[model samples]
Target chain A: MSIIIRGARLIDPGQQLDQVTDLHIKNGNIEAIGDLTGLNAASEINAKGMILSPSFVDILTYLRDLNQIQKGTIVSETQAAASAGFTQLCASPDTQPCSDAGSVISMVNNKVVSAGFCDLLPVAALTKELKGTQLSNMEALARAGCIGFSNASYDISDNNILLRCYEYAATFGLKVFVQAQDQQLGDGHMHAGATATRMGLDGIPVIAETLAISRHLLLMQHTGVSGHFNQLTSAKGVNLIRQAKAQGMNITADVGVAHLCFTDTAIDGYRSQYHVQPPLREETDRKALLAGIKDGTIDAICSAHQPHESAAKCAPFAATATGMAIYDMLIPLIQGLVDAGDLTWALAIQALSYNSAAIAVGKTPKLSVGEEANLTLIDTSHYWTLNSSSQLSHGTNQALANQNLKARVKLTVKRGLVSYQM
Target chain B: MHNLAELQLTKNGELRHFLTPEGLDRLMLERILDTADSFVVVGNQEVKKVPLLRGRTVVNLFFENSTRTRSTFELAAKRLSADVLTLDIKTSATSKGESLLDTLQNLRAMHSDMFVVRHGDSGAAHFIAEQVTPDVAIINAGDGRHAHPTQAMLDMLTIRRHKGKFEPLSVAIVGDILHSRVARDQIHALKTLGCTDIRLVGPNTLMPQGIDSMGATTHNNMESGIDGADVVIMLRLQTERMASAFLPSAGEYFRLYGLTTERLAQAKPDAIVMHPGPINRGIEIESAVADGPQSMILNQVGYGIALRMAVMSMAMSGQMQQRQAQALVSSSLKGEAQP
Candidate 1:
């Protein structure tokens, strides 16, 4: 199948290309870019007053489809990601059986291939069953199409075991994803601050993130391993990652999108939807995270999309599940940031699409000729409200439901095929 | 987000549920105190029962272990002439792996008029009130470290009976303020009752992060906290605090921050000492000071029944009124629909 997108402002930060132009795609590849006025294909899109850019990539997400279909499935979550303009997703290994074996990776790959909507890069568990005890078969997992290795939120308390895991990954030239959190100091449900005090809930201090990041940085340096930090929550954590990169440590970091939009105070009245892990921190931490993104200390922005069934969030605040089903409203939230002048269009596109794609796939996506057609068209002036009817994910536990959003994803193209359309 | 304080009241500004005292105004708090004052006389009578909740069914649902709180709530419900059913959820279907929502749904199906919930999770009562059973009245006996509204109101009763009013009083709450639902509710009640000089006395580790922002002063030393105070409230020191490293030892806590006779003397000459008891004698308070002439610990317990009865009756009446109003509106709409 072939298509021609006409008169859309194409933006590709990786190629520094931003102009209103026509593009031609033939057989799942961009055939021509500049003023393809005579090009004809089987399909045509009149993309006037729209933004055509490389489709977004989410570096961290959870698709618990294998055993927890009640929460979400591979097909359901990928469909939602496509609606939100993401064509690639790196699924975390915090699944029911824990993606620590080759079979689990194969199962996910088979499901993604059958779905045919987006690419799923599985991050295999570093430890067996993610119990932080024995190491998994890293070589076998890589052969099964694992993009990286991580223990997810579970910590390896034994320093010796952690050092060995890093050393083993370094030996194979593998990238290890670290979610820095000292479990002992991270028992609280929300960030340690005045809001937690007023609510009378336990607080997880900033030391939990800083201390764990500090240890992991030192260990990664010692083992000469390529490390990537996931969901940095505190200002001090950003400083640590910044210093490590300044010293030429082979490290990269990203922050969850929810953390950039909210602080601990959003948990007022004990709203269970705001109950996330690596809890929403204070305002200073939120501002610092934005600064880190602007200065390039933070590499990408992830959806951190965890889908839960309604029953999971139907309990008390502390007893309720610890995530929001964010994929259904991810782009609108980012659009909100851009409209408020808190983020620029270039940086937003870079963080959401180019940077995330490079980190997850080890190569940046482009909108130039001869490249595979992976694109998203966004109507920047479109005003829409997100509610249960508008939400596409199976998980209806959205925290931003019924909220007004400035932009909408009008269409998504993956491999030169229309994957999603408004 | 549903505010517990607002959820506890009807649109007519009457008590519908007694969940928390945080958003309650001075007039509403004074009304609760006044209502409890009338119930105090019923406890002294030969009958010791009232017909305020005669046809209502009150269910005491304790998801956590409790003896004193459960007994007081049960007695309060009984004295109000309401049929009471006590569910020891720790050994019931909850322990059999049933979810809290499932258990609540089963209980709700029983058509119980009110739920007296004491859970180990914060905001459990609020969840039930907002999500599960909006029509049923909910009394938060205790929920995690969030709130114990009835306990705070009873303490307020004790203070008013001894000191005559709340405006001229200085109150000091000492011990484990961070983990005490009673302390949090007490701070809100005290501030709303117009007590400006409220002091939270405990070690920095034991004090919550922003107690001062709740309109109370923080004091690590007991003497300074209770200095010239009219009422001194001591919270129970759970032995688990030592195991969790929140304190060095019980003996050390007693030496530094415990309410000894000397520390008690720092308050006013006629100051009353109170404890939400099952108190450790030497850990949080000395035996002499606890049983001293100025001690009102037992009176607080006696007043607890009256305070709970007042809250239960008020909430039941408010729920009835709200239902009646909703019925009226529906009937009027039906009338308009007819030809």
Candidate 2:
């Protein structure tokens, strides 16, 4: 049995689809990219005025499984992920017991595979429980099929330690993602800018992020092993990543929607919900990020969906939580980008669907005759108000709460199977 | 040791216990200075050693964790007298379950004499002073970021050795005056010694909310902060203490509010640098100037120990004498010694 999504504006940046077309799905694979009206399938989805595109992939996610619990379990996470159009999510190792080994990866993978919804690719931890003193069994984790590994949620202070992790990652054929920050310089809890000054908030100087990134990039050059930079939040950050890409180094970078849109100025009303590490930068940095995205410098955009209980971010500016659940907010954020002229439908596809799938499977996503039919159906132009009622994640920290956003998922098909419907 | 003043007793014509800077008068501070002079010279020897604190017990009861303060106290205690015992009870146990009174009671039962007390909550020293039954002395390292009396004394010693007397000199405490225990102690000590025209400098965020009541003028700019002052005291920014308060980034604070060489030039040519250690380098000040010719930072560290030793001995001996009289009366009333 196969599925056919009909009468949709199927935009595949990889295949350069801008006009309305019909897509054919058979046995969980893309059977046809042209007019599929003449072909017959087990199920047909009327996607009029909706986008029949590949489901978005996220390179950062948390999926833990030790003795009992997995991160929301693969079924639960994938259900939530599908509702938000995420087909593949890289499971981070920063879990309950902390994913520091191959058994950890295999344990998580088995649980996700058994749950069966979306692919839960494990991102292994770089150190022994990320202790920063010893290395994890990179070889064993690679054998267990971890796409990438990280120290998770922070940067290691020792340059030698990081360099070794990078070198070890290279041997395992996995890219290392550094959470960029100068540890000693991170004594403060807010962005190092005017808002922190006026509010009397402790600050993590933007230099801290850039300083770590610069060192990591330099080390990458020396080690000749490419590294990935995540959640860049400053104008200096924009230039560093742009320069690194221009220099032809094998470095890839991404930013959260918060950094792209929010700034330290948001703390004007002391909206503690907007608090984040690498603090939301200034308008100047936001503009720089927009420009970076316009170019090929910023390869992807991620949710950076860190879920902390309300008690964590419930405090005043100095004591509030550092992150919010953002996975569901990604589509609306990109929709805003499209409306603002900073992004095109084509570029948005490249950053979200194509690039994400590429990162996961180590290859680009194209709407060819034989590519896998992992497609998400959404009305890209539909305007709807977002609320916590629709989100499936355990956390409700989305900053875009109650905000009007474009697009709502209609159907989520993974591997030619109807995974979800709304 | 219910009262700090009662801790001292004249034993063979020597004062004991160092508890207050007010009583550690000029002669006593000067003697401690001389003692420190010998230690400073001895520090250059093959091994820094003396049998001074050989058998006597010295306990570092810091309820607060200060890298510089603890290390210097340890160094000073080692050089001066008997055994040095550092009991850092800043962890969960001291803050909650085991009360400060209980810990002091347990330690006193062991026959200790000196306690260099540094605590986050105010009145820790006064509370310990009230509960101590042994012939013990309490040295206020710092409390509630309120007053670090020994630091003030050492600063005074440094100033006196450089500027001669405190009666007519102008000294300004720059950087964070708001949450600095050092700033408060410095102000009290300077005011006591008769220093006129003290200026409190830095951003309003860093300066004490109402320092004018203390007879000190407030200045926001580096120029006004140091303007014409005989000695400028730089208070290291207490970044760790910025939890409840949002005091901006160290970079912005440093650029707009830090003390630089040019800023220091607005003061007297003989202006000396003084900071409680482990400088935030680029945050609170510039390195070129902190390590430059005008810095008396190392001298402050050296003087801190001697000042502490003097106060400890004075307080301890006072308590010994008071407790001895009580003991004498109790024995007489009991009609006979146990034997």
Candidate 3:
């Protein structure tokens, strides 16, 4: 298959390239770039006045496939990922019949391969059944096509066992994704503050993240493990990770887009859509997370796309399942970050594309010669409302529903295939 | 209108569900007090019954056990001539593991026109009000540390009947305001009724954070808080508060902050004392102060019935009006279809 995208503003953050140019693809690879006016192809996309960049890489997502297919499936949700301009989505291992063993990893990998919409890189559970009792067969899971190992927000009560798990993961060269949280202290459904107190809901304090992050950082230094802290929601957590990096610790961290956009005050009306794990914190924490993103202390910003059916979020705010369906709003939210001046387009692309891909896949998908054509064309200045009617995910719990977004995905191409088009 | 207060009203701002006092205005609150005033005369009469809610069915859905509050609400509904169904929900289908929604649905199927709810969870009453069948009135009896509007209104009535208007009153709410929904509702009601010099008297651990932001001055010392206050409201310290380590012991709490004769002397000479009853005597108040000449504590219980009668009748009236409006709209649509 051969195709050409013409007159698009190409941005390759990994290569530090941002310019309007024409690119040609053939046989699932970038054939040529610059002045492709004379080129003729079977399929030509008039990408005039569009920002064509490498497709995004989401470091955390819960497709909720397998036995928990009632929430979402690989087929339905991966397409939602495609529509969101994400060509590579690293799914969390928190599914039913979790991706702990090689068989489950293989099942997820095979399903992703068959779906063929986008790459669904499986993150195997760091512990067996994510119960934190014993370590899973990490070697076999890696061999079965798991990209990384994560406990997916499950707390390992035994720190000694957790350190051993880290040591073993380091030996196997598996990047460990730790969602730092003290489950015991994090009993509440929302951020601990005057807001939670006034709302009469239980509260999760900032120490829940900072204390856990501090412990993990210390363990990372001791065990010599490559730890990537997923969903750091507190300012203190960011400061701790920053300090760890300054001290030459092999660690990285990412914050969720919802954390970047909303705060605990968003749940003032008991709006359950904003009820996410590692709950949206206060304004100081939010400002710090954005500052971390801007200064490169935070390695990347991910969607942390947790999709849930309407019923899952229909209860009271505290009782409702935590997560927002953010797969189809990833690019738009990144654009919001850019428009707010907290991040430049370069930094946004680096976090959403290059940095995330590097942590998950060990390589960034850059648009260059002899590279696979995984690209997204976006209308970066368009405005649209993100209501239920406009959403493509099977999940209906959206924190930004009825919000006006200033950017949208126009087309997403994966391996030279037109995976999505608007 | 705050959350619960806003939820208690209809689109036209009429009282639909009297769930919280935080949203009711001075006029609406005065109307409730006035309505309760008329009921006081009825209570004093030979037959304490009215035909205001003659054929209406009022269901008391108490998820938590409450004998005193339940009886008063039952009496109020009975006085309004509404057929009352008092369900001991803790041991009913809810105890059998039926969800509150499912139980309410089953009860709604019984054709009850109103629900007077008392639950252990904050916002449980609001949840019921939001989920119940349309045109069904919901009166929050007492929810967990959130709001007990009827109790707050009765306190408002008790204060008004004793001391007159709230505009010039300096009220001090003492005790575990952190765990007392009555205190929360009273604070909002006091503020709405133009009571500006409101003071919350409790230790820092016993006070809810940001209570000062609600326009109430907070004080740790009891004497300073009650000094020059015209009304002193004592809140019952929940035993759970002690277990939660908010206080060391009931005895220790009584030693520091308990209302006694000496402490009551710190307030104005004309100041009256109030408590939503079933008080923990010696823990929250001394027996002498509770039984003193200025003690309107028992009067609060009497006003509680009148206040409940006011809320039940008002919510039923709002629901009836809403139903009539809906019927008119549907009939108008049918007429249009005929044309």
Candidate 4:
């Protein structure tokens, strides 16, 4: 419907729409974002003192594909992404029969072809089969419409493989996504320290992330390639990412919504659902990630969705499978940022929207008349958990069950169509 | 009496320090097993104290900890009517150069009779036994991974009671055969009892070199390694054991070496399963097999106490005289034996 959201607090980080003004939308495009109290359209969305900004974007998501345990193909995640207000996402190539080729990229892209819910992009594995031994066919994958190159497990045990990956992906002019974690240190489950101690559980120390990030940043500089560090956990890691950004390195980074929301302390008594790879870190590290998000060191927030069945998380902490929280973790997680006052409404919207759109389409979304209908219309006050029911992907692995969440999407519009309308 | 000073332990009323089962005699293991059998019922009793060591201090000066072993020792000592004191070396002054002898001297000053010793050095119990100047008793809880004498004795007791004899036994040890102190101790004890055929089986990464010196044939293949073995002793795989040597993945480890039903069938039809505890379910052995009808790992935990009682009583036998004398003097100071 042609509509004008009247007297709303429009926040356009690209245009610096921090001031309170009414936003006008017609034909599913942002027509004008001026003070229009008596603006005329088919419908007037009373967005007074509410955020009228572009929809959120999560650069990383572990979407489950059926035949290919690699990309985002699960029916559940697609619906949940729309509900959680993620319009665009990049799925890692780390699956069972990994996405290392153009065929695999085509496989994911084709499956998500009908997925008008969110803009799902396939992230092909940087190395062949995620063995960290050889580089995947970058040219072939790019032809298959793969947007990025990344090691799904991002396990760069051999420094030569890493250097070559950067060098090869650099040759393609395509950025690589790296879930960089040092293989040697930080081998434990939770974030190391008093939390792990109290839970009698082992933890991967924060130094592992910082060390891994530093190594990747150095590798990027060495190869002069663009790579994004997936899920920057520690403050030190944030500082390191910030340093790389300041050094004019073409390195972008993201954090999972869970990492932004929870701390390693959530692992008290071995709560399995809080268990994610490159795990939820310490409070200081969580704060650092928040600060990174706030200061733009962390470029985007992704829901590192991993839907494990019941038997997966039932074993002992060390023995259990590492991955949980797909459908119901994002909104509350972001809401937690707003609640704790670490995230501003404007900055969060920028990280969620234009920055992600910039990365996906390789440019920022402007307030001009003819912009593509890739927009998100969210009300500040809708609340519900779709995945918490039997339809939930939890299968009883919901870690943030009682956590308070606020702020939700009323409708997510992609290409001038209601991709996910609640 | 020649080695009376060395007798810091007593089992089945014998006087001797339980340093090595080799010179301690093959019959000593049987005697310990018998004494432990007598105390097994005591463990089940609500009033477990038998007054065998009442008013006596039993110090557990463990230099290395196996929570499974330490707990059993504590339970055994408490059941024997002794006041048990556990000293963990990791938290003590030994890390600061408090010599083992000096620590022993301090405990001796406190009138401790039995030293349930567990030291990281294999011969540490033997070292302490050699230096026991007077009537104190030494029960080797475990010393390094070299030997857990009581563990060996108890394991023997469990074997003899279950299988009736070691002479006709064919035992197999799987995983960590190289560095396991329990494997060494069990091997020696089994050898003393004339266990004719013993197989050492595990990946080359885990099997100790020169295991042929222990008179056990090393088998790289788990299928062939456990062939016709009467008892299977599965050791825990310590990831710490991995050096620069690249071991296979946990999945690979399980596939190649884990004691699944298929692998377990390689042993004798009636052979039982034994693990020293804290088993890695999928890595070294499967869950169904570990908790299966034939697994005695939990029983081994229970039998540890009886074996420890046998060793402690035997080691402390020589001290009975001095202890009785002190008791008489104290009673006399209380104006005659009141009863």
Write down the RMSD of all candidates, one decimal each.
1.8, 16.5, 2.6, 20.5
How do the residues A205-242 of candidate 4 rate in per-residue lDDT, one tens digit apiece? 77777788888888888888877777777888889889
lDDT of 2 by residue, B211-273 (tens): 566567888777767788889788777676466454667777788767788887887898888
Report the CAPRI category for model 3. Answer: acceptable
Q: Cα lDDT for residue B291, model 3?
A: 97
What TM-score does model 4 achieve against the real structure?
Answer: 0.58
lDDT of 1 at B164: 86
The best candidate in terms of DockQ: 1
Distance (Å) between predicted and true CA of B120, model 3? 3.3
lDDT of every predicted structure (CA atoms): 0.89, 0.71, 0.85, 0.71
Candidate 3 chain B, poorest ten consecutive residues by summed lDDT: B90-99
**DockQ in order:** 0.53, 0.02, 0.34, 0.02
TM-score on alpha carbons, each prediction = 0.97, 0.60, 0.94, 0.58
Q: Quote the true-contact fraction of every model.
A: 0.60, 0.00, 0.14, 0.00
What is model 3's DockQ versus the real complex?
0.34
Ranking by TM-score: 1, 3, 2, 4
At residue B56, what lDDT does model 3 achieve? 94
For model 2, residues A1-422, the per-residue Cα lDDT tens digits are 67778898877888777778788888778888768767888788788888777778877765423532322345555566777777778866787677887665666677766766677777778888788889888777777777777888766888788788878777656778778888877776567664454333456777888898899899888887758777787878879998988889998887777788777777653455787776787788898887777787887777676655554543334445567667666667777777788777677777777886676667877677898778778878778776767766555566777887787778877887777776
What alpha-carbon RMSD in Å does predicted model 3 have with respect to the real structure? 2.6
Candidate topping TM-score: 1
